[model samples]
Target: MRREEVVAQWQREYDSFLQDCMNRDWAKIARADEPNRDWAIMFEVDRSFINNAKSLLFTIENRLYDVLQFLLDKGADPNSSLRRYNSDRRCYESTTPLIEAVKIGNLESVKILLDNGADINFCVERNLSDRDVYFNKTRIRVKEPSDDLYIKPREKRTDDEKMYIWKYSTGELANMSPIQIAYNYRHDNIVDYLLSRGATMKVNIRPSGIFPFPFTTLGEMLRRCKLYFIKEVGLCEERYYALRTQVREFESTKKLLKGYEVRNAVPYPFRIVSTAVLLLDNSLEFKFQYMALYSLFILEYWNEIINSKTHIAAYAKVDDIGYLICWLVKETEYSKSTRQSLGLK
Candidate 1:
């Protein structure tokens, strides 16, 4: 047969396969998109790449896990990737079948893919623009009228490093691994499973992976707590005095923390930060206590907070502690010397 004839035949087979998928015909869907019996060959006809879409990718996208496994068993490339334009980020995102499975929260598919030839650490690189760098640096979160917080063009970065995202200049592309995507979507099972399978986390970590939600920055997290208290708890000036009285109790909390360090003979910045994080929790009965502990924590460790990127919230880009306190927390009682000591201008 001529080359044209062969191309026409393959197109017909692909169309037929797609139709079978639509018709929910599992038997027909088992057939490949090519006329030839080489099941491993990815279905593009006549030497054409054709957008890099593959049958395995499609099966994963459509939640056809059984079909996905069938293809993998038939020697399909487990790591076959597809590239598509992400309209929200205004950039091209390249993803693989495993990443898609993680997105859909299907651990079975994830395990199957990993059991096959899928690369556990497969990463897709997207170039970060100037705006991306800026947003990550400033840690800005935009609030909608619906009272929900979101950031535009969310980018994932390494969780262990400090301002590591900043090291990437404008137009610098960064790699986001599969484990990172799992963390972003809150698929804890997948994360733990990946870890068990020796999947490395050096390449994964969202803006606020340590927090309950994907908050862009520490300031954003604090703002969320403030808004929740004001809206749900009716935070008002009338309660300020009572809140202050409750805040005095933070002195004991501070002393307890200090005694912990002295007894252990080791400084625990993470322990301190975690305690501070709990103070911001809106589920607490006394939401006002966040004010006092927050202030005390800053006053006690402002220098350590600003100087060490690895100590506290690295993704928050907290280059200046004093500015963060004054602007986000709105503290007014600090004197010039006190503010100066806290690194406030």
Candidate 2:
């Protein structure tokens, strides 16, 4: 009954429980379950914090739900951080149970965690900040006149304010909303679901360094349309002409359109860029090069427009295409006309 003896006894009990869990000896675990089974002992195990439920949720393995249910029944804490077992290279420094659910797109797992009181907005110190400041900074204001007559009197507020005005702020993951992540990954279904569940679209969430001219989102949409047309319908002159017409319409709307629209358009140009890159090694030198150069210029113009804004939200919704375009131009050779067309020396 010395202190050391008590400590030794607890250690033995903990090790036994760990072995039972690892071997999945459910009978032993149940038998060993005392009145207050001291489930914290399981947390002390080296890999206990790492949930098998996560792998199951992500569909990396099968039958995860059953395992998770068993663990929860045995007293697994859903709020527990798995950083101890997760490596630095893994997505999001340490994997939380909720994040695992999100990545897997498993509504069941997400529901279970929510029911069990999992912190949906929990911020584990991975590379990105938990409360990204990205959402809070996004500007989605309705323009209103101010009292000042001499100066341009437009009042602006954050998207958070607009959401509050609309009474759409019940979900727990408000800090870094899951919808934002869905948008980042281009998970259309998830994005739609999140929006249905009260996710508000902010005008300023466009990816930074994009521009208004040839709007990035519009370009992206066009690119996707072209790819679909080529793969599904085959590349016909009519289809190509149709896409060009849309691009022209986009270009004409340059000054009036927001960055979000541009980011949304990025899919169009992205497809064209992909095709042009593939064709670069073939016979159509000038045509491919021209398309590529035009794409980059459009991206550059978008970036300039975003950066010119005083607020960060102005460029938050823009995609990463601008940076990609800049990189492409730096790495490739360009024609004289291409350079001149893009206003590059």
Candidate 3:
């Protein structure tokens, strides 16, 4: 028989078996398998049937296990190359059965795939080509900002340009790890599950692939919390002032009121700043200075300045003159801003 004829014959037999299964005529389906060579494809690369099985598993259909068992018994490959399967218009890159299970949040199916040797760290292509074609038709041209302190102005857009930008930004084109997809979708349960299973949340994966500073998981967690006001507060006191210096230039004078508000909310900003300054006295460095400035900014916003007496006491106790200079410069800037705003100086 020709390939087309064989395919047609296989389709007939597979359809009959599918109908029997749907009608709960298990005996008929069991007896339906015959000597048709085309029918063998049902046990080989019937993408539609495999997708149906996937859907059944996702929906917790009662006969899913039986269907899966039957397919396996007939020689369906669990790790079959998805490139050969043509079914509903789902992306071919996402054809992994394990990925389907993950998308459906079917823990049972996931376990089954894992037990059957599915790759846990599999990297599937995302639908970038489609997005690229769409974007090519309507690209936007953005202009660089004229000033560092202000937000950059967006270029005027035609409808096509706007649509292109929206589609390009919203499209899922890059291959994301299971953990990243879970996070993107706010699937907290899946996120926790993947983490517990040893998935690492790497920030950079290009060129040199440099991990962010303070690389420990705990440090990363803390960074996400945004609670650490300054490098000095959580870091060694010796380097605190040095770290503060680096971030000082980026401070926004216009946003001082907001900074003061933040300072008032937390552990008094004064104590926080003092702690950082103390740390800076011990370890002076540009990184530490930058972190210290961040802490100071938080303290300023919170309005948590220490009284002069405590500030002086802490200053006197620290031995490093250079550290004091950096601390003094930050204090001077804060003082100038506060005085100007409050009419104190």
Provide the RMSD of all predictions against the true structure, rounded to 1 decimal. 15.2, 14.8, 15.5
The digit string of per-residue lDDT tens for model 3 on 1-345 reads 556766776677667666666665666645554443554454564434433444334323333555655554555555543432224534335446555556656556555655565555554443433335654454332221112211111244556555543433333323334554454455556556666666544221111121111111323322422323332134454454454453454454433223122222222222222333323334434434443355434434322354311211111111122232234334434456643432223
Tens digits of per-residue lDDT for model 1 on 1-345? 555666776667666675665566766655443334343234434332222246666676677777666666656777777777778877666788888888888898898889987899877755344356665464322211123322211133234221333333222344567776776576768877887787653231222221112222234434544444343334574674466555556655664344223212213333333233435445333433453335434434433434322222322223222233333243345578754543333
Candidate maximizing TM-score: 1
For candidate 2, what's the RMSD? Answer: 14.8
Residue-by-residue lDDT tens digits, candidate 2, 251-318: 56552133224454331232223334333344453333334344544544554553321112213423
Model 1 scores a C-alpha lDDT of 0.50
Clashing residue pairs in all predictions, respectively, total 0, 40, 34
What candidate 2 gets wrong by more than 4 Å, as runs, is: 1-62, 73-75, 84-92, 128-345
Task: Score candidate 3 by lDDT.
Answer: 0.41
Q: Cα deviation in Å at residue 259, candidate 2?
A: 16
Off by over 4 Å in 3: 1-6, 20-63, 69-76, 81-92, 130-173, 200-345
